[model samples]
Target: MLVFFIAHFVLHWGWLVLNTKKCFRRNKEIKADEIIEAKHTAID
Candidate 1:
């Protein structure tokens, strides 16, 4: 029972960290795309 609780806590924490990293990467990609779009618009 104690082992199960510990495992659950670790898994939950790991999932949260993984999710945060994924979101951060996705946000960076979106920002890059927006910058590119803005530059193209300025050129045109």
Candidate 2:
């Protein structure tokens, strides 16, 4: 029972970390695209 609990906790923690990293990277990409669009608009 203890081992099962430990395994569940570890899996949950890893999932949360991975999800956060994915979100952060996606946000960064979106921001970069917005910046690029703004630059193009300024040039035009």
Candidate 3:
């Protein structure tokens, strides 16, 4: 059970990192902070 949990956590973290990188790459002109804010706004 612990191993499964750890695996899930690692995958989730990796996905988040990759997703963030993709977002950054999508807009080279925008700053990181702006991209983050735009993401949050789109989510909300």
Give the winner by TM-score: 1 or 2.
Answer: 1
> TM-score for every candidate vs. truth?
0.89, 0.87, 0.60
Q: Would you list the C-alpha lDDT of every candidate in the order shown?
A: 1.00, 1.00, 0.90
* Worst lDDT 10-window in candidate 3: 24-33
lDDT of 3 by residue, 1-44 (tens): 99999999999999999999998787775677798999999999
Stretches of candidate 2 off by over 4 Å are none
Model 1 Cα lDDT, one tens digit per residue, 1-44: 99999999999999999999999999999999999999999999
| Candidate 2 clash figure, as a count | 0
Assess the local accuracy of residue 8 in candidate 2 as a C-alpha lDDT between 0 and 100. 100
